[model samples]
Target chain A: MSSKPESDHDVVVAGGGAGGIGAALGAAKAGARVLLVEKYGFLGGAATSSNVLAYCGFYKQGPEPVKVVGGVADLVLDEIKGLGLGCEPFRSPTTDNWIILLEPETVKLALDRVLDAHGVQVLLHTRVAAVSRTADRLQAVTLAGMEGRWRVAAEAFVDATGDANLALIAGLPCRTGDDAGYLQAATGPIRVGGRDRSVPIDRARIVAAFKEYNWTGAHPTARQDGGIFAEVPVAGDMWWMMYDHELVDLTSKSFTQAEMAARSAAGDYVKVLRERVPGFENAFLLQTGPQIGIRESRHPPARYELTGEDLLSGRRRPDGIARAAWPMEDHSVPGRPVYRSIGGEGFADIPLDCLRALGLENLYYAGRTIGADAAAYASIRVMGTAFATGEAAGTAAAGPDDRIEGTAT
Target chain B: MWRKSGRFQSLAHATAGEMPAKRSCPGISRDIALLLLFATDDLAAESVAGTCNSEAVSHHGLERDFCSSVILSLPIPIMCGAISAIQGHVLGLRR
Candidate 1:
C-alpha cells in the first residue's frame, strides 16, 4: 500500500529456534505483525532438528514443576504432548517433564502448523545476509532465499539466532570466549538403538583401564564426577559426546578451522564412546546433531550483563522475565576436567533488562546472544531457559517500552 | 497433593525418599517424559520439593489429543540448584 515492494511487518524475528518462536508469537499476540525468517525449511532449529535429546528450560510446569515459559513455549509443548510426539520425561529436581526425543520431520510439520495458526509470515530456506539501519533503529533485513534476494522491513527486530548471527552482522557489540578463549566442546548428538544397558560396571576393569591409561580429563566416559553419571540416562537410548570447540570468529580461517575441528572432534567422540562408555560398547553412533551445540558466542550487548553473582544470589530483578537453574557446565577441550561450577540448590531469574541489546533502539536478542558475562553464560544458555528468555523478550518487544527496565534508562 | 494418574511405577527410592525416575526403564511415562522441558519457581523452597515436569507442556502442546497424563516425582534441586546458581552467579558479580 505504501508503494514499497519490500515485505512489511511490525516485528521481524530471525532464527527458528525455541526463542524465535516465543518472540514471534509474543509480538503477534501483542498485535504486532511479525515475520519469522528461518535458514532451514522448518522451525525448532537446534531443539527438534538437532535432536537435542531434552528440553532444557521451556517451563517450570507440566505434570511436574518446570517453569511456565508461557506464550509460544506453552503452545509448542501442547502440540508435542497432544500429538504423542517422541518427547520423554527428564528427572531434573525442579521439573519432571518430557524432553521431546526430536523426530525431526514431525517437529518441522508441527512447528509449521503452530506458526501458521498464529498468522505469522514465514520465509524459509532464507538466510539474512545483511541489515539496513537508520541511526540507531533497524529499517530492513536483506535475506537470500530460493525466490531470489529480498528485503523485509520492520519497526522492531528480535535476533533469535542461537549464535546471534544477524546481530553480529549488524555491528552490535558482542562477546564470545571461554576460560582459555577455548569454548566448551560441542557434540553431535547421536541417536543409537539396541544399547546394552545390562552391561556390568566392571569397576575393576574400568579402574584398571583408567589406571593404565592415566586418562584423567577429556576422555570418553571418564568423568570427574567420581564415576557417578546417573543423569546421563536423561537422554534415553540417545546420548551425546563432546567433539570439538566451535570457535566464533568472522575470519575465513575461523570458518575452515571450525569445520575441521568439529569433524575431527566428532570423529574422536565416536571413537571414545565405542572404547569407553560401558553401555555404548554395542552402540554404534547413529546420528550427529544438526546444530553443533554452541556454549559461548557473541553475547549481545544489553542493558545489564547477567553475572555469576546474579546466579549465586538468586536475585530476582523487578523486571525478571524467566528463570534458569542449570550449572556453569564448562566443557574442557582435552587436557583438563570439564569443570562444572560448585553448584548450589538455587535458581536464577532472567531480568527483563537482560534482553535489551545495548546502544540499539527497538532491537533485542534472544537465545545464546543475550547480555551475560562469560561466567553466567554457561548456566543461562540452557535450551529451556533460552525458550523462556525468548518468550519474555518477545513479550517485551511486543509491548511498548519507554526505556529498558532494571537498568539505567 | 494431587496424584498423577496411570503413568508408571517407581523403580527405587533416591536418598531414602522419592527417587528420580530412570528413562532407561519402561517405568517412565509420557507426561513425565515431557517435564524435562520445564521447572517451577513460585513455591518457596521449603513449600514444595516437587520437580516441574513437562507432562503439562506435552499434554497441552503435542499430546492433548493422544497421550495420557502421568504421575511421577523428582528431586527439587535441579530447579533450585539451576535457578539458585544462575541467580547467585548473575547477581553476585559485575557483568
Candidate 2:
C-alpha cells in the first residue's frame, strides 16, 4: 500500500497489541479522533502476527470462574464466542494452557471493526521512529512508512508499544530488569499443527522426563500440556508455544534486529520441540512470530508500587481498576518457569493510581508497560489484566475531568 | 515496563475516566496507573533519575507543591497523588 502525507489527529497510539488496540478503541469510543501506527500488517501484536496461541490472565479461579478483567476482557471473550472459536480456558496449567483462546484472524477482524466504528485511522506497516515533544509536552510523532516519512500530531498520545518504545524515545522515565540487568526470558512463539486431536498429550511423561533425564535439546523445552505454554486460537490445529531465552533483547528500538533474533530464537526453540514433545511424531511447524513476547519494561510512577503482598492478599484498592489471577510466571533459567501464585488465597485488584504517569497530564498506561517491580510485573503482565488496564486507562485518559488524587505516601 | 506480578488499571486518565476536561482532584482515590506516554515534550519528572529507583519519583522536588495544589484545587482524582502543584516550578520537566 502507498503512504499518505503527514496528518493531524486527536489521539495517536503507537502500539498495536492488546493494549494499543484497547487504547485506540477506548479513546475513539470516547469521541476522540485517533491514529494507530503499527510496524506489522496486522494489529493483534503477539496474538495475531506473532501467533501467540492463548490469551493469558483473564479469569479468577475456583468453581464459579470469577473474573476481574471485565470490560475489554469480556469483549475479547465475547468476540471469540461470536466467531465460534473452539477453545476453552485451561482448567489447569496442562489442559489447554490458555485463559482466552483468541483466533488471530478473528482478532484482526474485531480490531478492524472496532477501529472502523470509531473511525480510528490505522497505519499498518508503519513504525514510530521519533517522538516530537516540546518541554515534556508531546507535539507530534514522526513515522516511517511507504511514503518514507510523515508526522502525526495529537492532543494525547499512548505508548501501547509493548516495549514502551514511545516512552524511551520521548526521554521518559523507564526501567528494564533487576539491578543485575537480569531481564525475563522472551520467547519466539511458534505454531505447529496437524496433530491427532484425539491424542491426549502425555504431559506426565514429558514433564517427568525433563525432570528425570534433564533433556537438553539446544533450546528450552516444555510439554505441550505442561506447566508452561500459552494458547492462541486459529484455523486448522495450531498451538503458540512460549519457551525461554534470556539474552535475546526484544526491547531494542531496532525493528530488524529484534525481529531477526526473535525468529532465530524461535527456530532454535522449535528444533528442541521436535526433539522433546511426545506427540511430534507427525506435528508440522506452521508459523513462528517476529516479535519476542516481552515480559517486563518501563513502569509508571503513580500512587503506589504494587507489591507481592498486595497480589497474594488479593487486595483491592478503593481505586482498584482491575484484578489478576495469573500466577507469577517467569522463564529465565528454563529448568521450570517460575510460577508464584499470588497468595493462593484470592485475586488482587490494581488501583487506578497505578496507571497515572506522575508528571504527564492525561498520559495513561496499560498492559505490560506500566511501572512495576521485577517481582510485581511477573504477576500482572498477563493479557487478561492488560485488557482491563487498557479499558480503564483509555476511559480514564478520556474522563470527563482531569482531577488527580493527592499522594498518600 | 514488564517486571511481572499483578497490574493496576486507569482512573487517573480522568475523573471516572474523564480528562482534557475536568482538572480537579477529589478524594483519596488509590489510583496507581501510569501509561507513560511522553510528548517529544519533557513535561515533568514523573520518575527519579534512572529507572533503578521507582519509589523515588522524578518529581524533581515539586511533588509536594503539586500534591498540595491538587488537594486544594478540584475533585477530579480526589484521594490520589498529583505530580506537581506549581506546574512551571518543575525542574526535569523543563526540556
Candidate 3:
C-alpha cells in the first residue's frame, strides 16, 4: 500500500535471527535492496546469543532423514560445510528427530559470510524501536543504535523479531503465548568441556546424577530423565539441554532471574557430573549462555492463522509458500515436552497468507511472528521452518516484480 | 552500576509460574532496571566496534567504516555509557 514514496531500502527486515537472515537474503537475491537489523553484535540469533547449538526442523522423523527445508537455507548449510563443519543431519537419540549440530563461533562466522555474499546490508547492534504507520500500511521504523536513533522509511517491512516487536510497536493486535496465557518453558542449553570422549554417554548415570542432586545439591534440576545430550560438532564438547525453567512472565526481571538460576544450576550440575559420571570426572561448564533460550513470546495475527488441524492433517495448499516438517513439539509443561508428528507425508504446506499481516498491506510476518494457533506455532516456529517463511515473506514484500512464481491462491 | 529495584524483590528467587501479567512490554523503566543489572557483564559497544573495525573491513566496508567513525570518535568508556543511555532514552527509560 506504499505510494511509491522515496525510501531507504526496498525491504527492511527487523531481527537478525534465522528468520531475519532468510528474509534479508531472500529479498536481496530477488533483486531488491535489503537491510537487516539485529540487536546483538553477531548474526546468529538463538544459536549465538543463547546456547541453542543445534539446527532443528531440517529433517523429518523417520528411519531415514528426509530433507524438508531448502532454498536460501541451503546457502547456510553450504557455507557451514565450506567452513569444514559437518552439515549432515544427525539423528537425535532423545527426540529421534534429525538435526544439524552447531558450534556457535562457526555459525556466527558462516552467517556473516553468507549474508555478505548476498549483498544484504546488515546493521548489527541495532534495534527497531518505534514504527510509523498509516491505517493499513507501514511507512518506516526508527532504528535505535549505539550512536543515536534514526528513522528509515521502507517500502515493505518484515517482522522477524521472534517476539513480534515490530507489530507490537506498530499497534497491531498480537497474542501472547496461548489463548490461556500459558507459555512454553524456556531452556538453557550448556556446553561441558574436559569430558572424556572415550567413554560413551550413559543415560542411566545422568538420571542418577539428577536424582542425587535433587536430594543434596543446592540447585536441583526438574528434569529427572536424561534430557537432550549430544556431542557438539568440531569442538567435541558435550551439548546438554537438561536445564529447563518456566518463564514467570515476559518482563526482563523474570528473564534475568531465569538466566541467573540457569547459570547457577549449570555450575552445580557440572560438579555432580564430575563426581558421579565416569566420563566426566574433569567435566567443567564451558558455556552457560550469553542469554537464555526463549521458546515462545508474541504472535501477531496474519491474514490466515495456520491451524493445528492443518498441521495434524499435513495439508498441502495450492498457495503453499513453505513446507513445515517439524513435529508439534510442545513444551507447555516445564521439563516435559510432547511431540506430535505431522500426518500424511510428514510435512505440511504453510500458505502464503500466513505471512501476510491482516489489515496491513506493506507489513509482513516471518519466523515466530507468523500467524498460527498454539500447536501450529509450535510446529512452524523452528529455525528450519523460519528460513522458509522468511524467504517467502521477503520475496512477497519485494512488490511482485520478482515475486515467487507458480504459488497462486 | 544498576541497583536492584524493589519491583524485583518478589520475583528474585521465584521458580514457579505464578507471574501476574502475561505478555506486555514491561515498559521502559523495568527494561532499564534489567539492563542496568546485567549491563556490566553484557560487555559494552567496544567489542562490537572492534569487530566492525577488523573482521567486517573486508566484507562490509561501508558499515564497518560507519561503525568505526561513529564508535571510535569518542573514547570507549564514554561511548559505552552513552550508547546505553541513548538506548535507554530511545526505549523511553529516560526523558
Candidate 4:
C-alpha cells in the first residue's frame, strides 16, 4: 500500500445537491480546506439537474410567513436575488406556504459563484467509487470521473449524495422508505415556454383532458393530487410543469425508463394543453429535467432518528441545529399527497444527531438522506431544509473533534 | 359534508367532470378531515386579508398578472380544483 496520503483535504463532501453545497460552504467558512465532489458537470444537483426550481421549507407557514433558517441559506437567496435570477418569496396558492422560484440556469451560476468565493474546491462529473475506512473512521474515498480513478483523503466526510451513497459504501446501516421500503414517487419537471401570459389555462380542464386521453402512465388517479400539483410560472410566458414518474427504483435501467416515460408524458401533456386548454394554445415544451428527481431512497442511521410523531408533535431537541417549517408532505401515495401540519409553531427543530451516522465517527450525512422516518423525511427533505441540515453537518465536521456545542444529545 | 365550505362549493362548480362522491372510506375521510382542519384554520385567519388578492411576484422581475388575477377572483375550491390532480400509486411497502 502507498504510504502517502492521497490528495489530502480537511473535508470532503460527496454529492453536489443543496446539502453538498451547504456542507462545502460551511466547512470552508469554518476554516477547513474543503472539496465538493458531484456526479454532474454543474453545481446545483436537484435544483439544476432535476429542474426543481422552487425552494420549499424556507419559511413557517400560517397566517403570516416567517423566515426560520438564515446563515448560508440567506446568502444563497441574496446572491440569487442580486443576480435577478430568482423570485421573491410568494405564497403557494395550493399549500399556502411561501416558496422562492428561481431560474435554473441562473441557480447554477449562483452556486458556482458562492463556492468559488468560499475557496471550496469542486470536482464536477465525479462520483464516489469506493470508500476506505479503518474500523469506525472513514479514511479516504476513491473517486471516478473522466480523469479516471483518484483517491481523496480527508479528516471528515459528509454524505450528501441524497441517497446516502457514501455511508452505504462505507458499510454503515441505512434504511429506505418505511419498514416496507416504499419510497415516495419521483418527478421530472419540464420547462414550457410561449404560454399565453394574458390568459390563465384551466388546470381542472387540463387534468380531465389528460385522463380522457388515457395517458396517466403509472398514476391512474392523476386527478386528486395537491402537492405543488400544477405548472408554476417561472418567468413571463415560461413555466415549469411537474409531472409524476410514480415509484421508481434507484437503478440505471429504472431511471432510463422513467426519463423516456417523462419525456413522452411531457409531449402528451403539452399536446393536451395546446389542444384542450385555452391559454396554452401556443405553449410548447422547452426541456425536461436533466434527470428524474428522486424524492427518497437510502437514509443512513443516525444517533437519533426523527420520526413522523416527532414532526406531528413539534418536537424540539436542545441540540437542534435547524428548523423545518414545511408540513409532512408524503408523496408516497399516488393522486393527492398526505399532508400533516407541523403541530406547534408550524416548525420542527432538526437536531445535530440527524446528520451524524451512528456507527461511524467521522461520517456525516445531510439532504434527503438524513435520519428520518418516511413522513418526517418528507417534511425536511425539501431544498430549503436540506440547506440548513447540510450547513449544520459541514459546521460540525469542521469543528475540533466534532465538538459542536449544543449538538450533544 | 365538506361541500358546506364556500371553497369546496366553488370547486364543485368549476370542474367539468363529476366530482368523486364524498369519499366514504373511514381512513380517507379521517385524513381529509385532518387536512381540512388545518386548511380551515388558516382560511379563517386569512379571511380578513381581503379576497386573496396577493400578486404572484417573481423575484426575477417578471409579472404574472394572469396567474395573480386568477388566484384573486377564484374561490378556494376553484383554486384547489386547479391545483389537484390524480396520479397512480398508494403509500405502501415497496412491492
Candidate 5:
C-alpha cells in the first residue's frame, strides 16, 4: 500500500456511467479492490443523468444484428434481462443501426446490483475535485461528496468521466471538441405523455407542424425536420429528441444557458405538437431532462489517437481491446448531424493504447475520454463502446500484465 | 390490458411490431411479429401506401399487431415512416 495517502484502493474509477461501471466491475473481477465514484446521486451516467436512453455500438449496423461488444458488458445485460425487460437489440428503422433501448430507473437498479455483486465500493453524489500525481504517475484523487471532501490513493486510476475531468485535473494535454474547437450541438430528449395512444403518429403531420412552428413560433427549433422519436420501453411514452442547442463555450454558465434555452424550446414544442399534430393533441411533456445530452466536450490525448481513417477502413490491431461499430455521427452544426458508415468489416478495433493516457503512466481513459480524432470520436463515444473500452482500461489498470478476456469477437 | 413486468417495473407495452402473441388476431404469431419488426424500409413505405384493410393485414402479417387487436399497439408503418422521414432530413442522413 502507498503509505503517503490517506486511503487506498487498487483502482479508482472517476465516473458512474457505463465506462466507470465497466471499469469498477472489470477491476474487481480481476481480483483488485475498486472504488467507483459518481457525480450524480445514482449511476447510469447519461441514461439517468441526461436522459440519453440508448446503448449503441453493442451491435453492428447490418442486415442482421451482430453482437460486437461482450465480456463485462454482458454482466449488465444479464442483470437487465433478469429484471424481465427484453434486452434485445432494437433496430432503428431510419439508420438501420442496432441500439439497446434503456429505461433509466431499471438501468439504475440493475447497475447497482451488478456493481454490488462484483463487490465494488461505490460513492454517489461525488466528484473528482483534484488529482495528485508525480511526473508520470497519478498518486491520488480528492473526492467531494455530501459527507465532505476526502483524499483517496489508488495504485491505478481510470478516467471515465466522459468530459475528461480526471485527465484535465492531472494537467495532461487535452483538446476541446475537434481540432477546430467546434463542439457538436447538445440535444434535449424529452418524454411526451398524455398522448392519444389510440391514434397513430403521422410523420407528415409532424413535419408540416415543424415547418409552421419554425416560421413564427416563439421558440423556433433549428431542427427543420422533426427530430428523432422512439417508444420509451417502460413508460410507453414518446421519446422525442426535438431540440438542439449549440454550445457557445465550455463554461458552466454557457452550459446553463444552453440547458435553459432547450427547456424553453421544449415547452413551445409541446404546445405546437398539441395544436398541430393529431395524436399529440393532448401530448404533455413528461420529462424535459435533468440536463441536456452533451455530444462532445473536453477530450484528453492518449498513447495513440484513433483517426477517422481507421474507422472508415475498419482497421484491426493486435493490441486492440474494443470494437468501434457505431458510425461517425458528427453534429458540429446545431440541428445538423452527419453520419459516415464504417467500411471494410463494418467495425474498427480500438487498440489498448487508445485507452492509455499519453503522458500519465498509470492513468487510463474510457468512454468518451479515450483518445480519438473528431471523426473516430463520433463512432466510439457511445455507451456500448464505452463499456468495452472501460473494461479493457479497468483490466489493464488492475495489473500491468493482465489482458482483457473474451471481449474482441 | 397493460400488465406490469416484475423487477424493472416496466409496463408490458407492445412496440411497433412486437405485440404479444395472445393479443394478436387469429393468424398472427410471435415469429410473424419478429418478421414485421425487421421488415425493410421499402416494405414499410409500401405498407403505408395502402389503407389498414384485411388485404394489407394478411400480406404483411399485420393481422392484429399493426392494425386491430392489442390495446397498446404502435403500428409499424407509423413508426418506420416517422424514422424514414427523419433520415430524409437534409442534415441528418447521407448514404
Candidate 6:
C-alpha cells in the first residue's frame, strides 16, 4: 500500500472497535460516504483483539431482564445469533445481570458483513498519527500504517479509539481517570480448550483451589461472589480466561511489560486449574489475546458528563441515544472490585450530548473515550453501550447540523 | 463531591463490603428520621449539579420540575440528613 493524496469522505471513523463499527455502519446507512480506519486487521477491538468475549449493558437489571439496547446493537446480536455463533444470555447467579456470550471470530465476521452491506469502506492496519483541526472543527486526519503516512479529509470525524487518541491529538480537552489519575486495571484474556465437556464447574471448589495454589492475581470478588471472573465458555469445551494485570500503564513500554506479566500469570493459572480443579486434567491452553484489555483510559469532555448519581437514579433524557443497563462494574482495584447496582427497572439513558466533544463542533466520540465520570464510565464502557453511542454519533455525523438536537452542556 | 465528605466516605467504604465501626449521632439520626417520615413523593431531585440532566417531563404523570423544586427548596441540613439516612438504610446500619 502506498500513501495517497488527501482522500475525502463524509465521515471518517478512527478505531474499529464496537463503537467504530457502529459509527461506520450507521453513517453508511444514513447515505454518507463513510471510511473506517483501524489499527488492527480485525474489526472488534477489546471484544476480539483482547478476547473480552461477553457483551453486556444490553438488558436492564432486576429479576425480569428487559432488553433496552436496540438499533445497531440489537442487529449485531441478532446477526451473531443468526450465524449460530452466539449463546443465550447467561444470567449471573449473584448479580442477576445478563451477559450475551459471543465467539470472537464470528463477531468479527458479522461486523465485516454488516459494514460491507452498509457500504462502509474499511482500512485495517491503519493508525491515526496526527489530526488537522480548524478551530472547533476537525478537518483531516494523518494516518500512519504499514505502507506510509497518508492524510484523509472528512466533513465529520468520530473518535472511537477507546483512548480518545484523535481528540487529544486535535488539542481537544480530555480527562483521564480521576484527579489522581488512578485508572482501572487491565486484563489479558487467555483461551483454554479440551476440558471435560460434561463436567460442571464448581465455583466453590475453584475458589478453594485458587487459594490453595496461591493464585494472587485472581479477582477476589470473583472468588467471593463468583461472577467477576472474565472467564466464560465461548464454544464447545472452550473458555476465555481474563486474567487481570492490575494498574498497568497504557504506554508502549508498560504495555509490553503487562503483556509479558499477563502471559506468565495466565500460564500459572492454567497449571493450577489443571492440577487442582476437576475436569481440567486434559485441559490445554489455546490462545492469549493479541493485546491486553484496557478497562479505562482518557475520557474526552462531552456536552454532558454522565455521573454515578445519574446512573444510580436511572435518569432519562429526551435526546437520549442509548440505554445503559449494566451495573457500575469497577475493575479499578485488582482483588477488590466494586459492583454498584443501577437500582431501577428502566435503564440509564445515555444522552446524545455525551457523544459530542465539548469544544469541537464536528468531532464526535464514542466507546470508552466518551465523556463520563470514573464510576459512570464503568457502567457504560461495555460493548453494548459502546455500539449505541457509536450509532448515535454516526447518525449525527452523516447529515447537516439539523440532525444533532442540542448544544454542549 | 458529597462522596468526598468524611461521613459519606465512611458510608461508601462500608458499601464496598467493609465493616465500619458504629458511630452514634442522635441529633443527625433524629433529623434524618423526621425527613424520611415527612418527605413527600414530590421531593425527588431530578438533576443536581454535576449530575446528568434528565429531560423526562414527568414520572407517571408527576411533573419532574415540581419534584426538583421540592427537593431544592428543602433546607441544606435537612437534605444532608435525608441523604445520610438513606445511606444508612442502604447499608443496614441502625444508627
Model 6 global lDDT (CA atoms, 0 to 1): 0.68
| lDDT, candidate 1, at A397 | 66
DockQ score of candidate 5? 0.01
lDDT of 4 by residue, B1-95 (tens): 12123223222211111123223112323222222221211122233223222221221122345433443444564333222210000100010
TM-score of chain A of 5: 0.95
What is the lDDT for A227 in model 2? Answer: 39
Residue-level lDDT of model 6, residues A133-247, one tens digit each, is: 8777999989887879988899899999999999989987667776578888887667777678678766676677766655465332233432244345446645545366665
Answer with 2 or 3, whichever has the higher DockQ.
2
Task: Let me know the TM-score candidate 6 reaches against the reference structure.
Answer: 0.76
DockQ of each: 0.02, 0.06, 0.01, 0.01, 0.01, 0.01
Ten contiguous residues minimizing lDDT sum, candidate 3 chain A: A400-409
lDDT of 5 by residue, A1-409 (tens): 2233377998999999989988887777656889999988899888888888889888888889888787688899899889876779999755678999888889999999999999899999888999888999999999888877789999899999999999999998789988889888888988889898888777788888888888887667766557777788877888888788888779999998988988888888888889988988778988977778988899998988999999999986645667888999988888777889988788887877888898888999989999899999999889988888888788668755312111101
lDDT to native, each model: 0.56, 0.57, 0.76, 0.68, 0.75, 0.68
How well is each residue in A192-249 modelled by candidate 1, as lDDT tens digits? 5445767643444444444434454343433322231122333445444333444555
Q: Highest DockQ, which number?
A: 2
Quality of candidate 2 docking, DockQ: 0.06
The regions of model 3 sitting more than 4 angstroms off are: A1-7, A401-409, B1-95
Best by lDDT: 3
Error of 6 at B33 (Å): 50
What's the TM-score of each model vs. the native? 0.67, 0.71, 0.78, 0.76, 0.78, 0.76
In model 5, the number of clashes is: 0
Writing each residue's lDDT as its tens digit, candidate 3 over A104-218 gives: 8999999999999988999998898898899999999988878777888888999999999999999998888999988888899999999999999988999987897788876
Encode model 1's per-residue lDDT on B1-95: one tens digit a residue.
Answer: 00111111110011011223334224654333333222223223442212222232332354432222232133443333222222222221221
Candidate 4 lDDT by residue in tens digits, A1-409? 2343479898999998888887887777667889999998898878889888788887777877677766577677777777885556778776677887767777888898889988999999989999889998999999887867878899899999998899889988777767788888777677777777777656677667767666544433353321243345445544444466666466788778878887887787677668887778888988787887788788888987788888888876545667777888888764456778887877777777788888888888878878887779889899888888888788667754323211111
Docking class of 3: incorrect
Which ranges in model 1 have alpha carbons more than 4 Å from their true place? A1-4, A58-68, A86-88, A92-103, A178-182, A194-237, A242-252, A255-258, A261-282, A332-345, A402-409, B1-95
Interface RMSD values, listed in order for every candidate: 18.2, 11.2, 22.2, 23.3, 20.4, 18.5
